[model samples]
Every structure is written in structure tokens, then in C-alpha cells.
Target: MAGNSDPLSPRAKLAVTAGKAVAAASRAAGRGSGSVIGGRVALKLDPDLLARLAQNLDCVLVSATNGKTTTTRLIAEALRAAGPVVSNALGANMPAGITSALAGGSESKFGVIEVDEKYLAGVARDTDPKCIALLNLSRDQLDRAAETRMLAENWREGLAGSKAVIVANADDPLVVWAASSSPNVIWVAAGQMWKDDAWSCPSCGGVMQRPGDDWFCGECGFRRPTPSWALSGDHVLDPHGSAWPIHLQLPGRANKANAASSAAVAAVFGVPPQVALERMYQVQAVAGRYDVVQFEGRDLRLLLAKNPAGWLETFSLIDPPPTPVILSVNARGADGTDTSWLWDVDYTRLTGHPICVVGDRKLDLAVRLEVANQQFQVCENLDQAVQLCPPGRIEVIANYTAFQDLRRRVGN
Candidate 1:
């Protein structure tokens, strides 16, 4: 069990060294995205760098339209009970990000990776992970991700021939269908709050019957698989019908489901359920998802809402009677160029609440909120928007690029 006893081939070793040098230079130059650049250089030199580095490691791959980053962090923390764990905690989820994380943590025996939904299959195929956690799949970055169903199909095809044990959300038809073919699977009723993307059966193309929390297809009789783990309130029920209380510093029921999924993945590796849940409670924030930072003389709770589903879950986390909330949007490459998804969100939920829209696409959000008959103001800058809020702690929900910018500004 000595550290990375197998040395890389000379060529691959040189690639890693050069990539590290570039990463150092990029960091010194104040480029925060050095991981991507360094990984790109290493992969360009050695196409199979990720596979080589991942060899002989117990790896867990996590993917979903949302919650993948937080879930990955939770699983990584839980796995620390076993030994050292390497993960992409910086939100670099693509192949380059995975490569960067693996290269940096070469000595670690365990890896927990947050694979982008689009790159799940490719990364899984390369890493040959021992376990794969498939969280709920919903529409995200319509312009970039295309469609939810198509991505699920891609995942089904990509995971072919793999012997990995699959941990999947049973409530989501798309997740169920995508993972059905896997030989070994652990199902968890992690709860799916957004159902627009899963209204129809992915298999029979028939209308699904969602009576209470369970769903079934009327046409093909495809129904929700019996779950080995179920979330009841704040407790996760094990197969033996015992409940384990989950305490997390992160807010929302969505995070509870995330913790349940992480605990299931930990079980696959023989980590006790209580141990997994205990380790997860230690995680205060994943990147900057739920960190309260001082900004513009007000405490701002940073929440990331990239799609309609994300918005729905994030809105539920807002305190009732609605405190002042700042909504920021951006149509940058990472945020997806299509701002039309704004119309898909049920902004009506915020009916009597005070909202201030900011970011480059603030006008678009203004129109959406206005059409919903919600009261909101438009601000050109995030600081001005924060200033408009009534004193005390304010909730700030933002899309990808805007969220990153605010996190950088808050120095979180």
C-alpha cells in the first residue's frame, strides 16, 4: 500500500511534469482556471493519462443534471474513513478536470469524481470506476446539454459492458431507464421535486402515473424499482428498515437526497451508513453552493441555480414570507447561450416576494418576472442589487458564470 508504487511511463511522466509546470505558471499568473489548462496540456501529450493514473484505484463516479458537485464532495468525505481520497472539488467536471484531479492526487488510493452529465460515459469508461452514482437527470443548459432524454440515452449506451455497481435514483424515470441494463444496481428513492422532464416513460413513451411518491408506466408496466434506501423526512432508511438521521450544514431537502445517495455509494465500498452520514455533516459547503459571505455591507447566502429544476429546488430553500432575494443570470458559454429556459421556471412561486435581478441577462429575468406578475427590480450590478435588499442576511441565487464571479468577489 505504498503511494503510487507503479511509476508512469517516461513519456507520461514527462507529460505530468510539464502539466504541473503549466499549472504553477497559470496560478502565478492569477488564472483561476489553471486546472483545465494544465489538464488539457497533459491530455494532449498523453491521451490515456486519466486511465493510467486511475488504474488500481477504487473510484466512484457521480453524475446528474444538478447536485453532482455536492454529492461528489459528500462521497469523498465519507470515503476518507477508508483512506486518502482525490476529487475534483473545484467544479472542473470535464475530462480535463478529472485528469487534473487524478494527476494531482496520484498518491491517493481512492477517487470520487463529479462527472459532468455529458461526459459521464466517457469518464466512466476511462476510469473503470467500482461504483457509479446516477442522481436525477433534468433539463440543464438546453443549448449545451441538448435534451434530458438524449443525455440519458447517451449514458445508457456509454455505460455498456461496465461491471460497476450502479447507485441510481428510483423516482426519476430517466435515471431508472438509463441504469436498468446495469447488472448490479442499488436503487434509492432520493425524491425528485422537478418532474417536467420525466413526465413520460423513457421506455414505452407512455404517460406515467405518479400516485403519491411512486411512479409507474401504464403502457409498458415499467414501474419504480423497489428502493433499498428511502429518505423519510431527515432520516435515510436502510434495507433492514432502520433509519439513520442525516445532519448537514447545507440547506434544503435536495441536499438530504444528495446525502442519501452519497451514503448508498459508501455502502457499496463497505463503509458503515452511520460513518458516511457523520462524515457528510462535516462538509459546510461544496465549492460555494451554500456559503454566507459578507458583500456590499450585507451577508449574502450564495446559492447556484443553473436551470429550471435547480431554481425550483433553490426557491424551496428560501425562508417563507420571502426575505429579499437577488437573482442573477448570464448567457455565457458555461451558463448556456439560451436564456429562454428562464421562461420555464415558475417565478410565480415568488409572487409577493421582493426580487432584484442582476447580471448581463438581468433584463431577460425582469421580463420573465414581470410576466409572472411578480414584483422585482433590475440592477446593473450585483453590489447595487445587494444594497437594494433590506438589511441583514440576503439570499443570492445566480447561474453558472455569475455565481463564479460572485464567489470570486466574496473571496470564498
Candidate 2:
């Protein structure tokens, strides 16, 4: 591994193999149960070193069960409108990844980053951000997160003494309960909607009673506070029609929370709400999250659904195509080795839909599709699937690992 003092020349720095070697050596320092999470180093050496290099730069950290990436990107953009900024906008939420992003910057007033829940505490400790944005906690990555309560505890302990102002989503009851004890917390929420879900209380384990999309714990009666900040008004104008437009570059209910969280962070930084809203519309896609691209004559949308919550969100986005749609699933490490999460998704949304299935897990995805009564054509591989489709015009949904693998294979 290259020592901090052994600065390599620009030509040598461009070598990918050498860089990976250095990263591996850096990983070696904190051995046994101290592996890097969200790309931030475990020993705290790298971030501290990098922070000193940048002269204790002001920073913002965004953490959530979902929408961290999109929210982080939007916050970074809004901050950028004020000045230059650094962030893990590419989805590297661990310590080492945070180091990599900070290392890439020259100088900035703020380092805006999206942190994974598991690594949030450590990164928060090391980075010591000036602002922390907590989006709602939903059940995600049962294999990794274990349960939402575990994560809530992690945040509770991790952020115990943080001087940084806390921004939380009021719509998520779990977040509301957690922030109730926070010293300097601000709430952001989404209004009631027709397609809304998650009305359960995280406290006292009871079904929540909603008074117009506003939830109160049945057993504990812990009511959510109105938001200090929100993403949209009563309604917004979509191309189709006006509905509460999230004003984010991405689509869906989850993304709205992401947008609102970003706005909350921007507001904390003293960026005018109007300026934040205006800049949000200018932000671009964060790659595989919900990136749409054009092929031959078809519109291809690619989403990286890594776990049950993400999978359900992606499945819900699949509109009944006027034409046949193609769905692919892969078990590549990026998508995840365990494909059991497939059973948890509400594949019923695909019922009566025309579609095709492909990838190593094609048969498995097909079985799930069959349960929905969706007709599917089998393809030997992704290449075969894309060839079968009209090049540029098809919808492609894959888990995280599969999304990256397909992107490399298809040259997207």
C-alpha cells in the first residue's frame, strides 16, 4: 500500500490496478470485524487524514434505509449552487468510499455524503458533519440490516452526541419516534396520497390510525409533528397531470422522501427554500438508481433494486406496457448471491402484463412472474433479451449487482 507520504505521480495515479492494491492494503490496517463499510476506512485514519488535508471542511451526511443516494445528490447540487462540494453521489456509502470521494476533491465548503445505516455512526464520528439528514427507516436488506429496530438503535447510539442539526422525515413513524429525543431536530414530511403505504407505528408495535395520511400510534399515541420542511405543495403538475410532484429528478413515492430530505439539509445550510427547489429540478440521474436511456426507438429504464423494499418499488413502477416489456434478473454479486428476496416482492403488480424474462435467474424471475399471470418469453441471456427487443426501446429492471453487470455488458 502507498503511504500517505509516498505521493505518486499523476501518470502513476491513473493506474487502476495499483489503486486497487493501495485500497486493499489500506483495508488491511483494520483487521477482523473492522472492514470498511460504505467505502469509508475502518481505522478512521483515511478520513481523518483526508479531513486534515481539506482543513476540517464543513460536511453534511445523509442516511436512510432508502433514497440516501438520490437525497445526497440533490443536497450536493443545492449546495453546489452556493459553492463547490464533494460527496459520495455514486452510491459508495461506506467509510472507504467516503474517503475516495473526499480524496477526489480539491477544496470545498461542504462535503455532502449519503451514508448507509450500518456505517452511519462510524462515518458520523469520523467526518463529524455539520448537518445530518435522516430519511425514513423502512424495512430493507433483511439479510444486511437485520431489522429496522436494529438500525434505529444504531442511529440512536451513533448520533447520541452529534452537535450537527438533525433533519428527519416526519411521515415515517420510526423516524419521528427517534427524533423526539433529539436536541436539535427538524421534521420534513409528505402529505397524504392515494398510493401511500406504511401507516404502522414503529413504537408499541400497533397499527397506526391515520387522520388524513397523518399517523398516530394506536397503543402509544405518538403523533407525528407537521413538517418544518416539505417537498411539494397540495399538488404538482406532471406531464400526465398535477399530483404532488416530488420535484426530484427521480420518480416514485420513495424519491419524494429523498427530495424532501435533501431540501431539509439545504435549508439547514441556509440555502433559500426556493433556490433549493429550483436547483433540484436541474439535478441529473445517479446512474443505476432509476436511470433511463434511449435505445433504437424504445425507452429503457434501469433500476437497481438490491433488496425487498427496492424490489417492490421497482415492481410497482412497471406500467402495463402498450407493447411487451422485458424483465431480467441476475445473481451476480452486484444483484446479490441470495435470490430469496424475490419471494417478498409484490409481483402481483405484473399480472396480465406482457413481458419477457432473462439473465442467470431468468427461471426464478419467470416463476415469480408466472404467479402474477404475466406472460413471458424466455431468452438465453441479457444479450439475447436486448437483441430480441427493439434495441433502444425496452424496460430493464435488475437488482444492484445485476444493474452494474448489465450496464458493463450492454455498454451503457
Best by the TM-score measure = 1
Q: After superposing candidate 2, which stretches have Cα over 4 Å from the reference?
A: 1-47, 50-55, 191-200, 233-249, 294-297, 315-320, 332-335, 390-392
Which 10 consecutive positions of candidate 1 have the poorest summed lDDT?
1-10
Whole-model lDDT values for every prediction: 0.90, 0.65
Residue pairs clashing in model 1 are none
lDDT of 2 by residue, 215-321 (tens): 78778777988666665542322222333334556667666656666766786788865577678887667765566766545667777666666666666555565
How far off is residue 95 in model 2, in Å? 0.5
